[model samples]
Target: MTYCLGLLLNDGLVMASDSRTNAGVDHISTFSKMRVWEKPGERIIVLLSSGNLAITQAVASQLDDQIRLPGGEKRKKGSTLLTVPGMHAAAKLVGEAVRKVYDNDAGSLQQHGADFIASFILGGQVKGGPMRLFLIYAAGNFIEAGPLTPFFQIGETKYGKPILDRVIAPDTPLPEAVKCALVSMDSTMRSNLSVGLPIDVLVAKTDAHRVFHRRSIGEDDPYMMGLRKQWGDGVRRLFSQLIDPRLDE
Candidate 1:
């Protein structure tokens, strides 16, 4: 299990993912769940994945190879998503990768009760266009992030999603979006034992065409420490300030 989030912002996109994977309580390991493919100035795509580690890795590998899309009959070399012409095309390609892996492994994995499960959050921008974000399923289909829903989250999403819905907006400033992402992550880490620490984050700004900043936020990161405490205090304060409903009743 893991936690990954993609925030659609006025500036561009912000993506973050935790790196903990556990087969059992006694068997645990660290693996990167955040992936980036870039063409420098042409396009930049970030993918955050969760669920069945093997399945996600297989899907990513097939995408890097740019597998023949049933009829597209074209492929890429190291041809990860960054070369895709636009966000829509990139999304379709990712969905295809999911379908390919599901076809090859779903049945066998299901027999073993592994469920052949995986999901992805893909976001970035293409050169002549605006920024976009998508959530791709194991079924080879996806939906773009929209004005009403400005973000997509996968994996251990419940705890973090509340903060995002409460604080984020389509016009949020870039720095504020980063802070929101961290706060959201902290909430997930606190609530879910499976979603551990040491997070990977990528921040992209519009038309910059590449990642703006990427960081590994450790459990001991000072700024995150400060922000976490502040959020806790704010929540307590809000609770305290609420008028007692019992009096009205």
Candidate 2:
């Protein structure tokens, strides 16, 4: 299991994901759940994935093949991540790609007693449009993040989503959103052993349409360490300040 979150704000977008996948108590491994595509000042795209390792890897590989070709097609309409028109179109392309992989592998996977589980949070901006985000399902349908719902997440979301629900607003600043993302990840790592440290974060700003900042927070990163301590202390303080049953005594 893994935890990934994507925040879309008026200022830009922030995304984070942990790097852990476990098959059983003894079969634990590390794999990245984040992917980024950028044209540097032209456009930027980031995808957070969770679910079946094989399916997710297959989808990513197909998308990577289209753009990084050394000598392949003569078609002018060969749309890769770099050339996708906008976030919405890019999202549709991702959906189609997902469907293609599912069609090719779902039956075989089931026969092997495997589940066809995978989902993605796609966020970015195209050169001519405002930033946008979508959560694509395994069935190939997707929903964009609305103004009221300015962020999207997938995989092990319940343990860490409350802080985002409470703190994130559509107009939040980029750095603040990133901070919230790390805090959310911290919450998940604390409550669930499946989700671990060494999280990848990407922050993209509007108009610049590029990955403005990227960081990997390990078990002892200063900012994350402080956040966990402060948040825990605040929670304890809140508990202490609350009236107990003995208040009536």
Candidate 3:
């Protein structure tokens, strides 16, 4: 299991993902679930993945391979992320990649009693276009994040959703949005052992066509530790301030 989130704000986009991948109690491992591609002034793309690791990795690999193919072939097939005309086209490309992976491996995995499961959050900007965010599902379908719904999460999402629901908005500043993402991830980590740390975060400022900030937050990072403590203390303090029903009666 894993937890990944993406927020699309007026200033830009923020994305985060935990590194933990767990098959069982004894079979846990850490693998980055974030993939980024950038062409500096031309474009920047970030993808957060969750679900069956094999399927997700295969989908990513397919996109990578297509992007690296010779220029003529890439253009001829129109399958490369780099050549997509806009964010919407890029999202459809990702969905098609997911379908390709499913077609190739779903039957074999099902034979082993494994369900074909994978989902992705794709967020980025293209030169001469607006920044966009998308949530791509296992069925080769996707939805774009808009004004009312400006974010998306995949895998182990429930534990982290409340914070996002309460805090995120299309006009939220980039830094505040990042903080909200961290708080949401922290909530998930506290409640679910399957979503462990060393988290990857990416922020891109709208129309910049490049990543504005990126970092890997570890278990012992001072700032993160401080934030965790403050959040916990604040929550406790808030709980304590609530009126007691019996006393009021």
Candidate 4:
């Protein structure tokens, strides 16, 4: 299981992912689910993935192969992340990568009684276009974030979604969005043992065409610890203050 989220705000983007992967209680491990492709001032592409680990990793590796050559120069032969004209095209490239991986591995996995499941949250800005965000599914299809839906999440989403729904808006400030993302992740981790630390978070400013800030938060991080305690206590206090409903009334 995994928990990956992306927020598309007027200020830019906030993307986060938990690093825990588990087959069972006895078999638990951590793997960062975030992949980044950047061409400095030219473009910045961030992808948050969930579902089958193998499938997601293969999709990311496929994109990385086409993105640049051994010497780091951009590839010109195919529609690589670096060659995509805008965020939409970049999203299509990601979708295609997902399909390619599915075609090659899905049948084999099914034969072994497994399912070919994968999802991605793609967000970033191209040099000439507005910042955009997309949710790409296993079937090579995707939906863009819009005014009414300014965010997307994949995997173990139920526990964390409430905070985002209550707090996020298109006009939310970047710092506040980042804080919200962290809080959401904390809530998910508390409810689902499958989702754990450390979390990877990325923030990009609109039109910057590059990441504004990136951090990996672990259990010992002071700010995360403080936020978790404060949020928990505050929520409990608020709940206690709410008048109890009366069935008789």
- lDDT by residue (184-243, candidate 2, tens digit) is 898899899999878999988888888888988888798888899998999999999998
TM-score of each: 0.90, 0.95, 0.96, 0.95
- 10 residues in a row with least lDDT, candidate 2: 70-79
Name the better of 2 and 3 by TM-score. 3
The residue pairs in collision within model 3 are none
Error of 3 at 206 (Å): 0.3
For 128-182, candidate 1 gives per-residue lDDT tens digits of: 8889999998888988888899998898889998889888999999889989999
Cα deviation at 132, candidate 1, in Å, is: 0.9
User: How far does residue 217 in candidate 3 sit from its true spot (Å)?
Assistant: 0.2
- Would you list the C-alpha lDDT of every candidate in the order shown? 0.87, 0.88, 0.92, 0.92
Backbone steric clashes in candidate 1, count: 0
Error of 1 at 71 (Å): 19
Task: Report the backbone clash tally of model 4.
Answer: 0
- Cα lDDT of model 3 by residue, 1-249, tens digit: 899999988899999999999888899999999999898999999999999999999999999988775664636544588778788989999999999999999999989999999999999999989999999999989999999999999999998999899989898998899899999999999999999999999999998999889999998989899999999999999999999778563
Model 2 has an lDDT value of: 0.88
User: Model 1: residues >4 Å from true position, as ranges?
Assistant: 67-80, 243-249
- Give the distance in Å from residue 118's predicted Cα in candidate 3 to where it truly belongs: 0.3
Q: Residue 58 in candidate 3 has what lDDT? A: 96
Clashing pairs in 2: none
TM match of model 4 to true structure: 0.95
